[model samples]
Target: IVLQNCMDTNEPDSDGLTPLMHAAAGGHEEVVGLLLSHGARLGDRDNRRRSVLHWAVLTYREAVLRLLLKHAATDDPLLIDAYDESGCSPLHAAIDSGFEIGVSILMEFGVNI
Candidate 1:
């Protein structure tokens, strides 16, 4: 029932993020794919107006980011010019978290300094 549940629970949380959003944010490509197959809306955003791509970058999940990009579900306009309420974008978060590989991955996608 868990898989079925995950398939059905595409609803947003208090922060307005669905299962797909969380999966993408954490770079859970498999989960993201699963949710997508179940019709999870790709354009959903969190309370901060961040899309799945934004969260994926912040979390430094390269696989997830790539998967999202492949699906054209990620634009990440805030890639370099965004800041969360705490004053941090996905890139900033990746750097602050000491995810050097993550920073590099984001750069490959054109996230500016």
Candidate 2:
């Protein structure tokens, strides 16, 4: 409900992570969808240059990962292929973090190897 107010859904917090990133990290699939619907930038990255997909994968948010993937347009491969400060793509992060489901989902989405 608060999101329905005149608030900037893309506003980043002190950590440079927007609400969509937070929701993705916490596995809040519904909230992530809501934020996206509100115009949250799917390609928005944090201070580390990690996209929302990275946050979801890093935290093992399988459902959120899938949701983000489904919403990503063909031209939005950058979201799946983004590399963070540590030089890790969401796929790399998923593998490193042992998010097995995420790895498969990311691959299924055609994320660059």
Candidate 3:
């Protein structure tokens, strides 16, 4: 299914899930590819200021995370400087969720602890 352009880049949906967030949270590699091809904004944040990486790490969605990293023009954005409303980032989320795979993925993408 073709996701609408607005829908692809739109902010978080119900339950604070963006297309990028959903793709990352669910480990949907194809969906993540479609979203990126549709020019979805990688840095788009949810209501909590959590980017795709945040949800990816939170849910340990490894497949989606790797796809996103591959398609991303930036190896690592200024995500290190970004924080959620509660002053947390994807790294923090991974640590909190105890997702070792997620943490490693984030680190591989050049995100510092």
lDDT value, residue 77 of candidate 3:
68
Which residue pairs show collisions in model 3?
Answer: none
lDDT of 3 at 42: 79
Clashes of each: 0, 0, 0
Taking the tens digit of each residue's C-alpha lDDT, what string does model 3 give over 1-113? Answer: 44743553555676676777777788888777777777777777777788787777777788876777665537446754468889998788888889888778778877766
| 108: Cα error in model 2, Å | 0.5
In candidate 2 the C-alpha lDDT for residue 3 amounts to 88
TM-score, cand. 1 = 0.66
Better of 1 and 3 by TM-score: 3
**TM-scores of the models, in the given order?**
0.66, 0.93, 0.80
State the lDDT of candidate 1 residue by residue for 1-113, as single tens digits.
43655545557889888788778876678888877666776566678877676688767788887776656525334434455667676677777788887788667767767
Q: What are the per-model C-alpha RMSD values against the true structure?
A: 3.6, 1.3, 2.6
Candidate 1: clashing pairs of residues? none
Error of 3 at 65 (Å): 1.5
User: Model 1, 83: alpha-carbon shift in Å?
Assistant: 4.0
How well does candidate 2 score on lDDT at residue 100? 88
